[model samples]
Target: MIGDEVQVAFTKYDGSPHWHIGTRLLGEDEHGTWLHSPAGTFTWRPGLAFTYDRANVLCVPRGQHWAATLYDGGGASAVTTYVDITTPAVWSAGRVTMSDLDLDVVQRVGEEPFVDDEDEFELHRVRYAYPPELQAQARAASAAVLAAVTARQAPFDGATAARWLALAEPAWTPVAPPARPAG
Candidate 1:
């Protein structure tokens, strides 16, 4: 449903929790399922919890190893776009999940897009024992996403996100994520 709330969860390669957030279903397109997270939407991790300061639209592309969140800039962080290289998303009744590969492609306002978190990715690759094939896939996905974002490709271009955000803003309501389990 267009206005239904959905939980988006991420896990590490070893299956530990990474991030979980709530978003509203903002419909789908040729690209994939689009989700809307308005400002103040709660996000949770193992020992962290906070709300986003700016609205963003997340696109979970079908059968793709990467998912993207396009932000409406001018917030405390200048990050205008973030694409996570991950395993293909698994979708269920009211939730979606993916294993974060740690390599991220980011584009900050007015700056060239680049691949971020390579150090974390390298550390985790050894720590998690990511297979050679998986490592290759992650690296390839990061490079591809960085290029697309730099070229202002559709969806990464903000035009697609703007349309979905417009549809969602009017009916948007704040939704809290499930409470994080005590350590």
Candidate 2:
């Protein structure tokens, strides 16, 4: 995983339709890996979605107990950044895959810490027919990520991400604008 460019993706527990295509790989350490995504990504749900560009991901490669920091480049989206607390990820030399827990801790430059996606979570609760125990776990995961992000916890503190960003600069590739989905 470290020192290799890997395909990074996030999916629902059952590998349903929802996903997050990543910024590509730069490198990693004990804390986690840094994904340099110059091109913003499209986040979708059934139909509606938005793209967030100029972002990077600092991800812990743990499955079912993983977390990530999404540092936005602040292009068009109002969200400056977010922390996705999730199930641990499957990180390998070939790819990185994480499961979404339906909760996000979002941050803006001058705004209070915000929790986004409870509605989405509830929607998925019925849609995915999530078990009670699993739903509870997802909620707990959300709380953990929020606490870490709000407290500026290690690795989540931005220092590791910053260092990785500086390292990734020389290796960055300019991606063409992503193709828009057909109407």
Candidate 3:
């Protein structure tokens, strides 16, 4: 099922070393799909990757980024939602993948939704070697996300996610995943 717990992964910002691990599909809609963990997971990414790794204590195994809330999902909470912002996720049956577009939306209880690590975005833009086309796309997408988040649009406003959270509650029934033929 699309919303079921499955192992998945994405490229590091540098776009090498493809690694797919575990997380839930959450749900999907016109806005896009969401990946989440009730207790975050450790996403292995380097600081140079411009990934959000605040208060990182684990780095020996690999230069790790803390996803302190991703170990599991399908649970709903109004407080402390670590919404990962990417180029959206593409799903096929029980599998999923997305680009690490280098920005994440952290929606907490009372605070306004804010995009994390914009500095990382700029730093990586110069530090790493992103192709010109992907560079343009990333900049445009990042800007658009910032603008929409600033404007509090739809899902970014907290309303849509909140609604989804309610729907993801344990008692809520999950539907059979839709067929995602390879395009």
Candidate 4:
């Protein structure tokens, strides 16, 4: 139906990011589209007087005040295009610098040492950044592990949820246990 809600993954085309604005179609006159951030719902008309339609869509950060037309492809199938009001976007890496923080001088079990510069605090650094899909997959695995641990009545609870979650991802696994010498 025109009012159905769906999760559309944001796509980057030519560098700019866009969101599909929509609202639930109420009647023959009503149409739905989504917002870039998707804060809530909005409605439009069928006469093209407004900028929404069953076939219409809005481009993110580019297309200005113009209507959208969603070309239906027979039962939940359609190709959508919109007027380009803004220039194509360019992808640039965010300025993230890692400063190595030397935690070697720590003398306590739970004490965090200080670094001279704010940007120099890099006690932890990621090996590599994972894609969105991979991050989601990791989260799913972690959730499954927590569920299993809970089911087994492990001596843990919400207080230790973070620790348990961290354990979900195995950093390393031993191939075999060390053999014990016979007496």
Report how far off residue 20 is in candidate 2 (Å): 3.9
Report every candidate's CA lDDT.
0.89, 0.63, 0.46, 0.24
Q: Over 4 Å off in model 4, which ranges?
A: 1-127, 153-183
What would the per-residue lDDT of candidate 2 be over residues 57-154, giving only the tens digit for each residue? 65655454556655644566565456665667786655667767678888776666667989987897788777888788778877776776678776
| TM-scores, each model vs. reference | 0.96, 0.75, 0.55, 0.17
Estimate, for each residue in 45-131, the C-alpha lDDT of model 3 and write its tens digit: 323222222111100011112221211223345434443444445556665555565665555556776668778767766766656
Tell me how far candidate 1 lies from the true structure as C-alpha RMSD in angstroms.
1.1
Ranking by TM-score: 1, 2, 3, 4
Report model 3's TM-score to 2 decimal places: 0.55
- How would you encode candidate 1's per-residue C-alpha lDDT over 1-183 as one tens digit per residue? 887989999999998898999999989999999999989888989888888998889999998889999887557999888899999999999999999999999888779999989999999999999999999989988988888888898988888888888888565777777778777
Clashes of each: 0, 10, 9, 18
Candidate with best TM-score: 1
Q: Which stretches of candidate 1 lie over 4 Å from their true place?
A: none
lDDT-better candidate, 1 vs 2? 1
* C-alpha-based local distance difference test score of model 3: 0.46
Runs of candidate 3 exceeding 4 Å displacement: 17-21, 39-88, 104-119, 126-128, 171-183
The lDDT leader among the candidates is: 1
Of the pair 2 and 4, which is ahead by lDDT?
2
